[model samples]
Target: MASFRKRGCTCEKKKCTCGAKWEYRIKYVDRQTGKTKEKSKGGFTSKKEAQLAAAEEELKINQFGFAENGNEVVLNYFSEWLEVFKKPNVKPITYSVQERNVRLNILPRWGKYRLKDITRTEYQKWINELRDHYSEGTVRRIHSIFSSAIHDAVHEFHIIRENPIQKIKIPKDVENTNRVQYFSKEQLEKFLNSLKTPQKNAKYKHSIQYYVLFSLMARTGIRIGEALALTWDDFNEKEKSISITKTLVYPLNSTPYISTPKSLKSVRIVKLDEQTVKLLKKHKINQNEVILRYKNYKASKDNVMFHQHDGRWLRTNVVREYFKEVCKRTDLPVLSPHALRHSHAVHLLEAGANIKYVSERLGHASTKVTADTYLHITEKIENEALELYSQYIKF
Candidate 1:
């Protein structure tokens, strides 16, 4: 005989069916694909209610299938997307940078999570955790990679409704600015003076390269990569100009690679001062002497501007370490290779160089960036204004 139980069940455990437990299960053929799918609803007060819930879910699945939830697209899918999307569309160097961010940062965090389920709150929490573990700049770069990946998911996979990162604010820290520690003029002079003395440390012979590199950077405002990429051919001794068409870049765990300049503006020819040209000629002669001493070594015109004793290209990391040692010996502030670039801009502005000319020399996309960044050098503006006022005033 069929029995009807009226008393409701409060049992939450799956196996417990002590009371009038109502469980319903359904199997239906997808209307569009004619595929069999099974789903279940349980612990309802009544069978009819469970049936209704199951029907609604079945309808959603039948209409949208996996698209209804981003769970269907896995981490492997996003990885594939990143590779294909970046290879054809972005420059190799840019793609390499993105690849490192994805592998080292993004994948470890949200790779297993579904795109649709990645909410702003979840991202914010993850970002905060990352901030605690890593530097702000690193976390910011990871955020950019995740944001770009999610954006591509929307456009390519149609899996995400919108990018979750668009609404969330990035973490900020003091190091976000272009400002870097720099040697004072007197300290710089002292450091250069110290370089003239032979060091007790044989490894410190390379210290001279730091002086030349830093001095060039301080005078030219060129990026570290651009400085490393300079070649004998790029320098015109007769014309006193430097053609900046390429830059050196080393991606994480990869060998150094050369790439085009940062932008069209970065490809301009910069005129060198007389003193700068003289220094460059001296450096060139020194470099040529070293190459001649090691004639058996492979040295080609296409090689890097700077090289090690083995005739290998000098790694940026090695340069940075040498810079640190020099700073310590000279009792100067510890400044990064980038600080020289900042000093260059500041000194040029202080010497009454116009923002437009500075922008061109620095290869900035616009003068606005140059003006905004070097606004601290107001002495130039004051001197210019005073000169104009003197011409107009009548006593």
Candidate 2:
């Protein structure tokens, strides 16, 4: 219950004749102490405003058993919510992206605003501004993080009654056809061949490791993190398969660590080709020789299959940069290391491999995902199948 009173009123009976501000004193039983406690706020221009503010407070108390700080800054509340609810449950790399979005996108726009005071119109305008600046995918990710946090505020914390960012329009992104997302079969061959070619200015002495590393990705369609997390123990020599159960979490702002794969499907066994198995075996021999030459050197704690000379996990950036260099030297289109995974998938699909098998090999959640990602390839395959049927009917 709340009582409204006029402040600094010289003549106060039922209504004040003097122009005075209004205040409300709300009394509620604190659930923790089982005792009556009072909360009061002042400086409202009218009695109605004071009563409405008190009613909002009462609603929060009734819903959540306590009144949250209605004046809490948006950034401060979001930071706390992210730390308390999000960080522990998500992967380090995923948490980093959310943290970055809060800092770069959300905080700068609404940090200083009171958490309960943000209006829907203003939020929609801000979203529109963001859509103009960022790609649709990026804008969606940003919006998702912000909207998720706000949803918790409404339903979980009862900090706000409604989400301001709900149903905001996002502009569709134009596909950049000129940008190369993956390598052609010939380009992949050239890139892999160049990985084995020696360079005078190369920082890493063993170029064979690069060849084996990239070859594995191009053949297996595993993520770069999954490839980096491999250990000798993961390989089955007789079966010629590699088990993928974990991935490397390489965060730009923190130390790298090993974590579980992206999903349950990602924890699978990928069969290796005869040539790939031979390449890995030969690389193992070379690695063993290097270890034998330096008896005093210590092996990496994780015993990862790929590492630097000092037995540290190879930085992801180093691999990406070197991959670009290899592409340039081969006169191929410069693509990220992840392009190898895409190349592998494209080659498998183009070679008449089953979509389900490709999905499983790529560790996708479903064949639908694989089909959607390579929709153009599926269309091409459809056309080719029809052409083959037409040729057969000519007899």
TM-score of candidate 1 to 2 decimals: 0.74
lDDT of 2 by residue, 173-267 (tens): 66752233788888888778776766888554543788889999998999999999999999998999999999988889679899999999999
Give the alpha-carbon lDDT of every model.
Answer: 0.71, 0.84
Candidate 1 achieves a global lDDT of 0.71
Best by lDDT: 2
Who wins the TM-score comparison? 2
Clash totals, every prediction: 0, 0
